[model samples]
Target chain A: MFVILVYDTAAERNPTVLMTCRRYLHRTQRSVFQGELTAAQYRELTSALSTAIDPEYDSIVTYTARSPGMIDSTTIGVHLGGPGDIL
Target chain B: MFVILVYDTAAERNPTVLMTCRRYLHRTQRSVFQGELTAAQYRELTSALSTAIDPEYDSIVTYTARSPGMIDSTTIGVHLGGPGDIL
Candidate 1:
């Protein structure tokens, strides 16, 4: 399965989480990684990531299996909020 | 299962995909949506999203089950590239 994790803050993007994730998953491209992880491995990785992140920023994580159909459904957006807002 | 759909451009954030997704899933919050979809539904949604996007921006989609461990594993980041580059 492939998982896409999005964080609203740089603090949440810690080196530990990035290195650990890279160790388990192949870096498909810069800032983009892909791997087929079992449910157990997925849990371990997510837990490690959450722990390393600072609580001040919001984070959104999504996972999907490898399928052409699933890949087709994926969407992306960016929001510029009010002053001092982090989204 | 929960899915995180991230788009790097507003063009990819089409109303059709968002509405269809909302009809199937609950809106967890503004810019954040959640729901339990079968594999089939996931395929349909991703497919629709991919078609709606302009070819200019990069989009990343991630999916994961509704496990505490999985949620904990998510990570997010932002990259500022060279001149005229969009991250």
Candidate 2:
């Protein structure tokens, strides 16, 4: 399975969380990681990484796909700005 | 593009935002929406939806996959529970 994590500036502070995440998942690029694992393994890896994260520094969004067909093809974004930002 | 909105109780309250989202995207199932749109269209839709959302009631996570190969294959989860929830 593949897991993608996108973090705002705050999330970058926790080195330990990033390190542990790197240990289990292959870092495909900066701030993005990927790997194929069974259900059990996926659970185990994410579970461990979550604890090491500091909630104050990070807001994480994880996306999991069992099959390529199930993937979402749109550009998903969260607007962290003011109400007027939406147009 | 496929966008999945998973709400942790609070996100369900904003009917207006949900309605707007439904109007633009095809609701594939409960809380999940799918459709194929150009980059400009996707941005416009999500931009509008973000404004009507109430921050206290919801935390939104959006995943956009342009191609099937970029999709993550792992089971992505967030443990909102206590620290020990990690195993």
Candidate 2 off by > 4 Å:
A9-13, A68-87, B3-36, B39-87
CAPRI-style grade of the A/B interface in model 2: incorrect
CAPRI grade of model 1: incorrect
lDDT of 2 by residue, A1-87 (tens): 655544322445557656666665654323444455677987777687666556554444445776534554222233233223212
Candidate 1 Cα outliers beyond 4 Å, as residue runs: A1-8, A11-16, A27-34, A37-47, A60-87, B1-6, B10-23, B27-33, B36-48, B60-87
* TM-score per candidate, chains pooled: 0.42, 0.41
lDDT of 2 by residue, B1-87 (tens): 544443222445557656765665554323434444567877787677666566554444445666434543222233232223212
DockQ measured for candidate 1:
0.13
Best by DockQ: 2
Worst 10 residues of 2 chain A by lDDT: A78-87
* B31 Cα displacement, candidate 2 (Å): 24
